[model samples]
Every structure is written in structure tokens, then in C-alpha cells.
Target chain A: MSTKHTIAVLVNDQPGVLQRVSGLFGRRGFNIESITVGQSEEAGLSRMVIVTTGDETTLEQVEKQLYKLIDVIKVINLSSKPMVARELALIKVKAEPSARPEIMGVVETFRASVVDIGTANMMVQVVGDTVKIDAMIELLKPYGIQELSRTGVTAMIRGNA
Target chain B: MSAQTPEVRSTEQLREKWLKPEVITGSEILLRSLLLEGVECVFGYPGGAVLYIYDAMYGFEDFNHVLTRHEQGAIHAADGYARASGKVGVCIATSGPGATNLVTGIATAYMDSVPLVVITGNVATTLIGTDAFQEADITGITMPITKHSYLVRDVKDLPRVIHEAFHIASTGRKGPVLIDVPKDVSAATTLFQPDDRIQLRGYNPRTVPNKLQLDKLARAIEEAERPMILAGGGVIYSGAHEGLYEFVNKSGIPITTTLLGLGAFPSGHDLWTGMPGMHGTYTSNHGIQQSDLLINIGARFDDRVTGKLDGFAPHAKIVHIDIDPAEIGKNVPTDIPIVGDVKTVLEMLNPIVPYAAKADAWRDQISKWKAEYPFRYVDSETVLKPQWVIEMLNDTTKGEAIVTTDVGQHQMWAAQYYKFNQPRSWITSGGLGTMGFGFPSAIGAQMAHPDRLVISINGDGGMQMCSQELAICAINNIPVKIVVINNQVLGMVRQWQELIYDNRYSHIDLAGSPDFVKLAEAYGVKGLRATTKEEAQRAWAEALETPGPVLVEFVVEKGENVYPMVTQGSTIDQMLMGDA
Candidate 1:
């Protein structure tokens, strides 16, 4: 089953690194769940946060394969380690005057913020594990949810600078 | 007084003993080691910087040199050889221009996951980076394409490094490895003893699947109501055809192949739904779309297969199995992921995957789709269709031949028409789509499987690109068959341009070309031609019966294109036949 795990990969930002990495997974018929890239601390290097899950052996193979690529410097499986894992979800829920207080009470319990509001619905933003987000959505379902969007898990290791 | 005169009575030596250096020059050591590692040939062109190595090659007589038309051809030839032979194919090129020319081939190999060892000569250390003639930083340029590469600064490292290169190239999700030799390094001598053991810190390859994950996968497969197996090329790479067959049979699931996965299952089998995706069989595409649980085994979900990503298999849950983890969720969302060699994963799942009767209903539905929408090629008139030529070749060979094809309509037709009963028998550039891969790959396949007949089914445009390599087959007694489908144009691209681009005729139509028969005769290979179905059958029979390499050109109808084509962004249900 798909488990959202964050892996930090360091690669030389060459012309075809993305294609090479994506092609490797594609060739093996593994679909990468999600990935995000940005400049890393090292010079001429970039860090990519890849959220993907496979069997333990396959995940190790993926790390090994990534290292085989000329541009890849390192791969760290963040999910298996003690790390900070979180995701941001923005959900719009419909509520009448009678359900507004209950919605506020649910939002306060989860420490969620009201990002936007209309006459019929209120958009709430919450950051937590997938289970927590799902729980909050389930609670809001009785009041009628309008829309939901999630920035799938983005995580990093907790450490000192 | 005689003792005092010292007439060479020594403490240790009275007779000469062979020096380790004399037992092998560095290049000779490299060549012999590669041969012992099962490299029967090297595709290359000799040049100044690597003269000593080329000369050393003469001492290793068992190793043949495939003189390619260009350095790029050498690399691609090696790529084809690796793909066809299921072994690491070696290629040698000189420095600078030769090395630079190999880049595209290396990239192609890298993209397609071919096992290749590319050896290139380097300018001497003293002249390095001085803008010397015939010098370039190949190791740097090829860094991205190779699995791993080395710049041998000293001759002593050549023997061990070459062995390691071979090991690394053929092992663990195989890809190309490069060994760059400086001119002086090849000339310098050292005690040469090739190490059989390689101790790389980070290169351990695991072949076994995680037991826990296997259990999970088994449960998923057992519970899946509409299970479909999407087998890909990795099955052949793993040599796990038997495992795949056993798992699919025991589990009683329908199997479909990607273009690269054509031979993973027996082509003519009932369970084998031809290829799936755009241009895929109706049953295969429908099977994928309607499947509740898709068991993707070593098959990449290419864009061609998934026409509109949003609408692809929308209701299906994917159980993806691959050796590489990066592929787990690269494109489609996977509900269950198993990472291990396909063969290993399949083996683990074989016992646990219950023989469910649920897939029977799905199979029955798919069979109806298959019967309703069978792949067709019309021999409506006197002109010979390329598909008929392919089917005739298949008939002549009895599906026991190693078939290689270049890129284009002929390639697609061959994929559709030919019935491959064996694994690793059908070789084509599925991922990279390189045009001139057929002839050289056929030569290599023939060399590897001497008793089996090897045939190159190529397009006219593709044939023209690598026709020069046909000289190598004639020079050496490599008995391979070349079947050129001469349609007088870049048929696939031309068809697309014609259909979608308002029939704007560009430089794609090659109206007149050198007489193919005369051309083949010039290279000392027998030439055969066919303009009709009977003539094509006779030509194929004659070519198959021929003792040595022969070129047979089937003058197919011009402007002909492959049908059942799912136009770009079109769903499988919307496939356009030729009449469209």
C-alpha cells in the first residue's frame, strides 16, 4: 500500500537529471507519488523531497539506483527515521447558522485556521498527519463539505543547523 | 680467477622468467579480461590514442571487432547487442570526436537500461586540458549516462577496473559503464592480474523481495476482483519468464505487455492480450481501464499508454511491482507497492495469490472485446503490405527466431504481426526509439545464438542509416538476415504529418534511392526483392534458407501506415483504423 514517506535526494542539477530519475522509475513501472525540488546548502547542488513508497527492498533499490545516477550525491529515507512529517490541507465546508458553532468548535480542537469565508461556506486550513486531516474532514462531513485540496506530505528531519 | 671475472652466476636467477608486464600490455589485459567476462566482440573504430590497445586486440583473436560506420554506431551497436544478447556489450572509441560521437548512443543506452561498457582513449596526462587535438573530457560528458565511469590514471588499475566495469555493467538494474584510458596509460606496463572480486562500497544489488511486502502484495492480489497484469521488459532482464508465467497462470489473471514487454509472455498465448496503450489492442486497453486492481510488473506507464492521465484507470487501484523504488508512484497513484526484481516478487506471490474465479468474468468480457476488435491488415490488392511480410517471416521462422527491428511503422507492425513464443527473442528499441538499432543488434544476436536464425526487420529510412554496417556481416561470416520494408518514406512520421499536419509533404519522402539489390551485392551479401505477397513469401523462405547474411527488400506500398492507431490524446476506444 502507498505510504507517504519523504526522502531527501541530493543531485547535480544537470540537464537530464529529472528525466533520468523519472525514467528510471517509469521504466521499472513505479509511479513516484510526488516530488519537490529546491536549491540545497551545497554549491552546484540541488535537494529534492520525493514522497514515494515501495517495499523495503525496493525502496533500498531505489536509493541504490539513485546513487548510480551520475548526478545523484545522496538519498536519505526520511520516513524510516525519526523525522518531522506534516501536510497542509485547505478544506471548504458548508454550514448553516445552526452548524456554524459546531464547525468552529471542531476547528478550534484541531487548531485549524479559517482561511476564507463566504455566505454559505468557510475554508479551513489545517496542518497535520494524513490521519488527523482525514479525521477533521470526516467530522465536517455532516455539515456538508464543499471542496478539499491537500499539498501531499512534505517532511524533513528534525535537527540543529 | 673465473669466479672473480663474474660471468653472471647469480644468487636467485640463472634462466629468464616471464615478467607479469610482458604477459600482458594494459590494453591486452583489458581485452582478455572482457573476453573472460563473456564479451565476444567490441564495436568500435581505431584511432591514434588507442593504437596500442587496438594492436593488443590482435593478440586476443577470439574477440571480433565490429567496425561500425561511425563512433555513434559503435555505441548504439553495443546497446543493441546488449539488449538482444542479454549480456554486457562493449564498444571502443578514440578520444575527442570519437568520444563525443558516442554521447547520444550512451544516452540512448542509459534511457533504455542496456548493459554496455564504453571504452574511450584519452589524450596523455601531460596534454590533458591543454586544448590538444583529438582530446575531450569524455568522462565528464558521459557522467550522466553511465551507471559508473572511471578515468584510469595508471595502467595498474586497468585490469581490475575493466573487470569491475563488466561486473557493474551487467549487474543490478543494468546500465552503461565507461572506462576512459589516457594514451600513455595504455602504453605503460604494470604487473597485470585481473581481480575476480569487486569491492565497491555502494554497489550492492539485492535480488530478493521483502517478505512483509510480498505478503501485502499477495493479499492485494487475492482480494482484487478485476486483476490485470501489466508485464514489462524487466521480466526479460531478470530472466524471470518462467516465474511470470507461473504467477499469472496460478493467479488466473489476464496479462498485457507494454511495447517493451512484448515477449515477456508467449505472444500467441490465450492469456496474453497483445500490447496495451495508445496503438494497443482494444482488449488490453479496456482491461487496463476497467481493472479494479492492476498488477504492474516491471512495466512503466508511459504517456503513450495513458492517453489522458486524468481519465486513465480512474476507478482502479494499482499494485505496482518493480526493482527500482523510484517508480512506485512516478505517474499513476499506487494503492499497493512491491519493490523487488519482478521475477522474485512474482515467485513470492505465486503461492499466496489464490486462484480466484473473479477474474474469469473480466477475462470473458475482454475476450469479447478481442473478438470484436481484432488487429487487421488488408492485402486488398496486388501491392504487398508490410504486416504480411512480417507474418510471413514469423511463419518461415516458426516463431523460433530472434527478431530485431528499427524504429517506425515497420517496427510497430512487427510488434503487432510477429508472434514471439520465447522470451528475449524479440529485440527492438522500445524506450529510446533509436532508428538504426536493428541490423547491428541482429548481428550481435546471431553471434550470441549461433544456431538460431536472427532477422532484422527494418524500415527503408532506418536501413539507409546503417546499411554500411552490413559490410561487417559480409566481412565476417555472421549469418544474419536483413528484411527491409522499403516504403520510400519515413512512414510513421510522414503518416502523422499527412494525417494531422494537413498532408504537408516535406523532406520526409525519399522518392529515389540506391538500388537495394545492387547495394547488397556491392557488400558481397546476396540480395532478394519482392513486390507481391507470393514474391514476399518466396523471398522470406529463400532468405531463411540462405547460409549466410542476406538482404531482402520487400517493396511495400508507399504511403502505407499502421492502423488501430490511437491518435495523440485519444482513448483506446477511439482508435482510428486505416479507413478513418
Candidate 2:
């Protein structure tokens, strides 16, 4: 019954606000897959998108508990609505003369762009859904991925209806 | 424009005419804010960090401050006052150890939804997070426990913070609120505005029940053949006793209460089925399990109340009405969850509920169970039974005294024996079950209502934990009757060990303790000891007659355990009726 959920929370941009929000999740035993926070359109407010995995009951509790926090203004389960979710990853792969052409072909197929090229390595930037990004990483793993940095998923509702 | 004309006057003149603001020190503003909130007394411990506030407290005619022996005692006293008087209680402590000492009491109040405004003085703003002397991050530590907390970095925000603390503490599923004031903020000066209302955007509590939900609930209650009312602390907190009484009387539904909801309805009422949970009455527990419709009011389905989660109230269609939305369906699946004040919802439903004829067969079944498995204990001529002593106390006080208790076997016994007639008459540590809460809380109840009789029923083991508060009663002449049921062991733990762990009593035997009579005498309070039933009666009479505080020690039979106990993970029906 465990499934993934994307929840967006709007909170005041004050000291210890993030700690208050995340600490509640940690205490309540919610497993956070990833979390990303940024300034919202409203002044002095921040938006946080948390990807968590839990049963339906626990996810409902998570939303109720989030609203209990003092700094939290609003909470929305992005998965319940029509939304777009994306993650950005910068993956560096070791590319020798023999593997350079193969790595380029794989990156092109995934619609990724090479941000930096080195003699021994090349850093490819990929922006896609989590599944697509994971697929790209798996495809480049045989070419020897040296290092990787990923920005957790950020989500937005789809339409203005 | 002539200078002498009224129209030529400056804009400052218009502002000053409409809003009168006086410059005052933060300490003075704090006192003024408390006065504005209608606070008459505060239980507090003074320290170096709070010297300025204490200095401002001097010669303050509006407030009466009781200095407690320890910070923990102060907070517990405040909690008791709030619980017994149905008003927001205030407590103060300095930073570091003083603030940390209140952690347990704060958590206790938080669990029980006692309204308390706890103020702690922190080190100067400059020394914060620098590990300065007597510096502690109390706000951060109490964030999860408190309904809301404020750290006043600026003196200008002191008045507003204090107002908000009181508002948050007393309103909307009431709980404790903390305000941490830095020493510098206390010493600084700011414009004191007397009537600035709080406006927190995210802090609105739902007070009115949905009309459609009420209609559904009323129809369900009318349609069900076997319906019961399970009341909790929210009944008392929302002052819904009158509404509850009216509803139950009109509908003729059998009523059962949680431990904290002891006094919400009169124990002597014909429709009362007694408390429900572990150590609850046989009829009450069995009735809940067999009922077709269970309407829970204000009480969360705590694990203790629901022994085996899957089998608890298995046949009931649950209708949970609570002020806190988070508590609804948090523990057990609820069929109808109505989030609103209990009083409001009950008032709305009282008129709408179609009165159904009394189900005689259900009542006859419950009466038969009650008669068959009544609360029982063997009376011995040689040793006094704790139950007899409690019954004697109840007989003498006529169940009118404000009774507080420490946690253990004694607490459960008191709950079973005491016949409470009104709300706020029975105050005890319910949720957290703090061991040393009785004596200090009794002091608080006594202080709140000086003319009323307040008794603290404690076990010898739990009493010793905070026995130092006895001196506060003696010094202040707060005449609170203290009764220590001396069984010479941690009775509840020993009972568990005996039943579950093969009677291997490890460190549970608390024998050869200090003579409680002598200890009370040492504190210059009257000390009485009773070894027999006649002697206990005489001692109770003497303690009641004495004007000053009295401590009565009753030596009773050891190894006495609370009965109708549901073993861990067992269903409510599977109870071990001990020694019956």
C-alpha cells in the first residue's frame, strides 16, 4: 500500500521554519525521498516540495500534522492534482577516446546537454522527470560516472482553469 | 491658515488624541499584559536572568505571586490551577536548568490540554547561542510540546507576544504556550499599548459544527438501536457538561467517560456506566465493545482505551466530535468526524436529535453485567485496604472536594472510588501520568479557590518524588490535605512484574522509607498516621478539622493491584479480574 506522494507546503520564510517543518516529518516517521525549497511569489514566504513515500493513511496524517506547525501557511498534495514534476541532475562521466562517441549518442537520445568537457571526463546536465533522469544515469553508468549532483524534484500545478 | 486655528494643528496631535501610548520598560509591559489578560496570580521561581521582571513584580498590587521551591513544582501548580479553575494559569522560570525543569510539566499540560502560559527568562539577546551562563533555547526545545511559542528578540514585541500567549493557551483545544523573554528585552523600554488585539493569520480554530454533519449524526443516533456516549476531557474543556447532561437525559443513552473526563457528568447519575479503558468498569468496557453506535465526544481513542486496536468497539459506527481535527481518526477509524467545540456541537444536536424509545433489553444487559462483576476487594480486619480508605475519604468529603492525584495504582483507585459531581472537581495527571504531580497541583487548586477543600491522594512512592513541596504548603499556610497511601512498594509496576514477568520484582519494592508523619512534622505541618480503619476515619476527621496543612499517612496492605485490568495486546473483554 506504500506509494510516493508529492506535497507542496507554503511557509513563512523565518529562522527555524524549515527545521520545524522537517523535524515534524522526522518525528512522525514519514520517509522523505527528496525535498526542495525556494522563495515563493509572495514576499517573505517560501514554497517547499517534499517527495515522500507512505501509505494513504500516513500521508493524510502528514498533511494534517504539517498544518499544525506554526510557520506553515498552506499545504497541498501536488500528486492529487494535475501537476508537472521535474528534477535536474549534473552527471560527470569519464569519457576516454573509445567511449566519447557512445556517451554523446546516449546524451543526445535523452535530450541532455553537455555543460563541461574535460580531457578525461564530461559533465552532462539532464532535466526530466525522476524516472527519465534515473534512466539517463543508468545508461551512462557503464561509461563510468565520476560524480553526480541532483536537485530534488520541484513541482507545479499544470493549468490555470 | 492661522496657527491658533484647530485645522492648523499638526498630524501628531490627531494621532496622539486617538491612540494613547506610554513608554514603559519591558518588565512593566509584561505585568501590564498579564493584568490585561485577567491573570490574578502566577506560580514562579526567581533566578538571576529574571531579576528585572521580579523587581518589577515587587509592589505590583494587581497580581499575587507564589514562589515555589522548584521550577517543576511551579509549572505543575499552574497546570492544576488551570485544570481545576477552567482559566489560563501562568508560571515563570529563568533560563537553562530552570527552563529545562519545566519540560516535564509542560509536556504533561500539553498532553492533557491544560491552559497554561509559561514565561521563561532567557539570557541577554547578545549572549544567545554563545553558551552564555544560564542560557538555554527553551523555545526550540518546547516547540513540539507547546501550542505556540515566542522568543522575544525585541522589547517592542513583548506586549503583543504575551497577549498572543494567553490567547493561544486558553482557546481552541486549549494547551500550554511558552514565551521566552531575553534579559535585555526585559530591561529595554518600549511603547506600551494596552489594547492591541492579536491577529495571527494561521491560528483560526473551528468553533461551529457543520449543519449537515449534525443532521447526519442526529439521524444516525436516532436510527441506531444500541447507542452509547463516550466522553473525554474535551467535555470539561468546552464546558459542555450541561449540554451533555441534557442530551443524555433526553435520549437516555448510556454514558461512559475517560479518566480525564471523570467529573464531566455526575458519577451518581442513573445512566452513567462508569469509566472505559484499562482498569475501567466491567459494564462500561463491555458496553463499548458491544454497542452498535459509539458517539465519542472530545475524547481521543487512546491506546489504553482501545486495548486491541482491531477488536476495539468492533461493532460500533463511530461518530467522533472533537475540537482538534488532528485527533479525529488518528488512532481508530472514525465513521463520522465532526471538528468543532463539544459544547457548540452538542447544543446544536440536542434539539435536532429525535428521541427514540429506551431500549429496555440493552439496559437490562448492562445492569446485569454491572451487578455481576462489581468492583470488589477483600476487606481484612488486620490490614487496611486502599480501596476502603479511598471510599472513606469519599464518604467524608461527599465527593465535593477538589481531588488531585499522583500517577500509579493510587490514581486509578481514586478515579474508581471518587464520586465527582461537577467538572473541574477531579484533577489528575492523565496523559503523561507524571508521578510527582499531586502535591503541587493540590497547592494550585487550593490557591485558586481558597475557601474550597483540596485533597491530594498520593502513593508513598510517587509522593516521595516531590515531597519537598510539603514545605511550601507549610510556609505559605496553604491548607491542602495530603494523603499518602503507604503500600511500601511501587504497586502498579510490581503488579505488572507479577503478572507479566513471572513475579520477579526488581527494584519495585520501596520499603523502609522515611516516616511520612515525621517528615510532615519536620516541615511544621500537622502529621497524622493511621494503622486501622477506625484510626483512618479519626485521622481523616482530624485532618479535615485542622486549619493548617495536614499529611495523613495510611499504612495499607502491600501487593494490592488495580483490577479489571486488560493485559497488554488483549481485547477489553479479556480482562484479568484480579483476586475477585
Candidate 3:
């Protein structure tokens, strides 16, 4: 029953902190499956979003464990919140000139973008839920997919401040 | 009135009563609540923004903290904890890098369906989104991996969010949850209400199995002859071992557990065929291949389980019972789909399926196959076989222990040798094939079953991935026994390489490693070295007697592979055992 969960952590911008955090997870043999770091709305502080999964008691332990780390200021379980989660994918498909229009029709239906176009290949960008992305891939398979890439899922809580 | 003169209270007492509020930092309150709720420990890293939480932790001596090498490790530790304990694991990371590091661990946990709560600190409330120094769009980064997520802009939301995270993590399908807190929120002043109350639409999880679905499932079971039971991690999650056991016993159908479902069916049970899939037992392989009806309970048809999808159980009618509706037809097509917890599903279906007492002929056929290809090690002549170590541990522990395993040959060896007589006694990373899962999983398992002996059967290669975890055990006094099968190579991959690529051993060999005994000493934990059968037995005996965390390093011969292995690109019948 080892399922992964995503977590967003807020901390001070400093050195040796990332090591400390990741080390804690590894040291516990907790799988820090994936993590993304970037600028937050707050100045001086950084936001780290993580995805991991465990049981309720274990996660409660993790929350308490995280509070003990000196560099970590606050922690959030974004998955338990009422929020919106999404991911982006860039897929390149090959189509004959004659079938180009048909491909465009499907793209328009999903509100996707034709980011790049070549004589025989078209690169389209789509952003939505994972299911939507998967559906798009399945639809484009008939048209011949050349290459595909995805920016893993990201999320934001719903409602205004 | 004159005798009883009214006395004025001291200024300090009046000030304490009238002005001094019962003060506690948000982080400390959070930690205290978690401890009160039976969270004895947590895993995480520290940062500037989260300094307040660390300070708050100083006051609560009841809670133990294991500082990970990274935030990702903290999340992973929580994952391991949750997996082993059957409860939501918790971790904390600072903003930016700290929070970001938790992403991979969270995603891993999400895919595996482990319940976890991750907490991160952000900058003060007023300075949000100013292109802050350590700030990042964490909520945005974690969307796909979590069941749900939360960002708390105010202090009042902490208790509710935490409560919700715990509930969601333990309930339903179970996955990870996150909460982002601004720095000021941790320090903000607010009335302390320890009561956790939260109400949300579209968030209710089913606690009881749907009866209609159960009826349909019973109908499916009643019609089958050559039936197969496919068990998954969900059975463990639902704690439905008794119900599942009763149903399987009454039906007299052989059980084939998945990698995640290993311990769901007691290994020692006569009806327990074995694991099914690429590396599954010949009995399980044949059972799945020949079955006319497949009853999949709480298990997904992972590629390893359904190799060469077109050829997998082509004639079987699959009846899939799961809590997640999305999983019904996601992997393999289903003839009948029942969505609910396995425990409830089995309970309701237990009565409907009449006691068709004895399938003596079918049971005899299965027993014949089981005898022909019992899960046994052919190469017992080696100097130090990992399988023997696992067998000895199993014997010594008497099936009353909780065992966690890291990925690779050692894991499979443990699975094959260890007799898990009870449910929830074995924990590992089945979905992700994640390495380094054992040490921390044992830590969490030990916490959950304080009196039970917890053992981490680890491979040299996998253990090296997070050897630092030993330090956490040492510092926190979590007395998990670590049995490292020092094969000096990545045994599973090495086996694959030998079997397929002509045995040109590449980077898989590890001729050099730190002295494990010294390594344990450095971590302030006890160490035992074993090379022979006697040494191993003696070491294990000593380990059992030890009071604190101990590492027993067995210098097993290199290139010792798990046998009775079904080679890749071959049918289940075409197995490659020792000397074959």
C-alpha cells in the first residue's frame, strides 16, 4: 500500500537546507519521489512542492517530522485541499498534407495550440488534467505521433484570497 | 464580613488571568496535536523560513524527529512510514528547494497509493508573490500527484487542513496530501481550539462496500470453474485479511498475490499458490494462464503481471473489484467491475456465494503443480546465500515480525523465504520498484508495532541508496534490525544481464564499500557481521537480544541470484531454475 503523495513545503532561501530536507526523507527511507522548487509569492522564502504517498499515521508523522527540521518554516498537504491540479504536454505528430486539416480539427476541439509546424510534422501544446492529456495522446495516435514530452502535473488551490 | 477580609490577587496573577493568553506557536501546536494523535516521529529537513517550526519543536520533547539528507528523503521516509504502518506518514520541508525536493517522493507515494502529509513553510503573508527569494509555485507543481492539496494563508486553517490531510490520507484509495504555510502563519496569534472539524463536499469516502456491486461479484464467482484470485495492496489497506481468507477458503480457489499483494495471502497457507507475473512462481504462472475466471481484488494488472498483454490470460473472464473506479478498465478489460473497498466487497459477497464446499479435483490439480514446482532454492551450496539468511530470519522471528524489503533480488528472496503468517506484516515499494525502501519502512513499521520485532531485509545495492537512514534510526532509538545481503552487486539486474546480455558484468559490480560494521558504529548503532550459517544464526540471535537499532551485514557471495525465476520474454512454464 505504498502510494505516492505530493506536498508543498515553504522554507527560507539558504544553503545546506535542500540537502537536509532530502536527506531526512532518504534517511527515513521515505521515497521523495518528485520535487519542484521555484519562486513563491512570498519574498525571501522559497516554496518547494513535493509529491509522495503514505498512510494517515505515517503522513501525520511526516508533518511532525518536518516541523522539527530547522530550515523548514511551514508545510502544506495540498492534495487534501480543495484545489485545481494540471499538467502540460508537448506532442509532435506526423500527418500527410491531405490529413492536416483533420488533425487541426481535433486540436481545436481540445483548445490545444499548434506551437510548431513542419512539412510533415506538427508540434502541439496541450495543458489540462492528466486524463485529458492521455485522451489527446490516444486520439493523435491514429495520425502518427513522432515524439512526446510532458511537464509533470502541478496544482493550485481554488478560490480567491 | 470583617473576619473574612477580601484579599486582592497579585498583579502578576491578575495579568496572567486577564491579559496573558495561553500562547503556543502554530507549528508547536501542530506538532503537539500530531503527537497527541499518536504520531511519535516525523521525517524532514530545516530551512530559514521554517526556523520557527524547528524552534516550536524544541518545546515538545515527546515527538522525535529524523533529519533526512534531503527534503525528498523526508517525503520518501514518510512514504516508507505510511507503507509499513498503514497510516498517513508526515514530513516537513522548507520553502523553494526544500518543498521542491519533496516532489519526487510525493509522486512516488502517489503512484503507489501511500498516504502521507507534507508540510512546507513560505515567506510572510504580506510578501507573497513578490518574486520571493526561496518561494516557488509548490501547489502548482504538485497538482497531478496528490488526491488534493491546500495552501493556508491564515493560521486558523492549520488545524482543519491537518485534520483533513490525515483523514484523506487514511481513507478511500489513500494518497499523499500537502499544506503550504506562510512564515507569519506559523507565528500568528489565534485562539487555540484543539478540536479538528472539517466538512467538504465531494470529499466523502466510502467506508462500506456497495451491496449491489458485491451481489454482481458473487454472481461472477458462482459461475466460474477454474478460478484465480488476484490480490493487491488494497486488501492490505482495507485490513480485510479475515474476510478475504474466509472467502478464498470456502471457494477452494488458489490465490496468486501481486508484488504489492505478497503478504495478503499468508505465505504458509496451503492454498497460497505464490506471486504471479514475470518473476512469479510456476504454480502462480500456470494458475493465471489456465484459469477460466480471474477475480482481481484490489490489484492492478501492471505490465510485470501481464507480460505480452495480448497473450495474458486470453481466455479468462476478468472480474475486477477495486475501490477506484478509474482502475476498472485502465489496465485490463473487465467483464464485471465492482468499485468499493476490498473488505466490504468480500464481506457482502461472502454470504451470497453459496458454500460450494469442495473443489477436490481442481484442488488436487493445483497441489500436483505446487509439488512439481515448489518455491525452493536449488543452489544451497553457496558460501552465503541470501535466501538462507531470509529463511533463518523467518524461522527466528516465528512469523510474528514485521518485515520491510528494498527493491531487487533481496526483496524477492525475502518474499520467497519469509513466511508472513499475518496480514500487514510485510511492506515494500511494489508499484515503483523503488530502491532504498526498507530501512525507513522498517522505522515506520517499528513505530506502528512497538512490541513486534521489525526487520529490514535489504540488498547491498538498494541499501547503499540511502545508507544514511541508519543514522536516523540511531538518533531516534528506533530499534529496527537491518539485514543487509551483501551480494556486492545489483543482483536482479545482474541476473538479467547474465541471462540476456551474455554476463558481461558492467557497472553492476560493487567491489568497494565501507566496512559495514564501522559504518554502523559511525552512526552510533550496533553492527554484526556474518559470513557463514553459524555466524548468521549467532548474529541474528544477538540482533534479537539487542535493545537498539542494529545492522547485521552478511557478506554473501557475489552474483547470488534468486532462482526459480521466470525469465523475461518467456512463458511462465519456461522457468530458469538453478543449473538450468
User: Which numbered prediction scores highest in DockQ against the true structure?
Assistant: 2
lDDT (Cα, 0-100) at B483 in candidate 3: 86
Which residue segments of model 3 deviate by more than 4 Å?
A1-161, B1-25, B32-38, B68-73, B125-131, B193-195, B207-210, B356-358, B380-382, B567-574, B578-580
What are the models' TM-scores? 0.79, 0.95, 0.73
Q: Which regions in candidate 1 have their CA more than 4 angstroms from the true location?
A: A1-65, A70-74, A77-161, B1-24
| Best lDDT among the predictions, by candidate number | 2
What's the true lDDT of residue B176 in model 2?
95
Task: Go through the candidates in order and give the clash count of each.
Answer: 9, 0, 147
Model 1 agreement with the true structure over A33-61: per-residue lDDT tens digits: 77767788877778787887777556766
Q: Score candidate 1 by DockQ.
A: 0.08
Residue B267 CA displacement from its true place in model 1, Å: 1.8
Top-TM-score structure, candidate number: 2
Report the lDDT tens digits of candidate 2 across residue range B1-580: 0123334444466345324578878888888788768787899999988989999988655567888988989999999999989999999999999999999999999999999999999999999999999998998898878888888998988877888888888888899999998999999987887656977766788989889989888888777778888999999999999999998888888899999999999988877888888999898899999998899999999887888998999999999999988888789898988999999999999998866465567777877887787788888899999999999999999999999999999999999988998999899999999989998999999988989999999999988888888888988899999999999999999999999999999998786789999999998999999999999999999999999899999999997989979988998878888886
Clashing pairs in 1: A30-B327, A30-B328, A31-B327, A31-B328, A31-B329, A31-B330, A32-B329, A32-B330, A33-B329
DockQ of each: 0.08, 0.63, 0.03
**Model 1 lDDT per residue over B1-580, tens place:** 0112334433234211211335556776776667667666788998988888898876444556777778876777787678777988889999999899888778878767788999999999788889898999887777667787888887888878888888888877778998889899888876667567876644666668778877777777677788888988889988888998898788888889888888789977777889887677878888888888888898778787777777788667888887766666767778787777887777777878777566777778877887787788667468988888888888777888889999899999898888887887888887778888787778777766878888889898988877888787788767889999999999998989888899997789777888898899999999999998888888878887889999999998887778777788766656676762
Off by over 4 Å in 2: A96-98, B1-20
Give the candidate order by descending TM-score: 2, 1, 3
lDDT of 1 at B212: 85
Model 1: lDDT of residue A65: 64
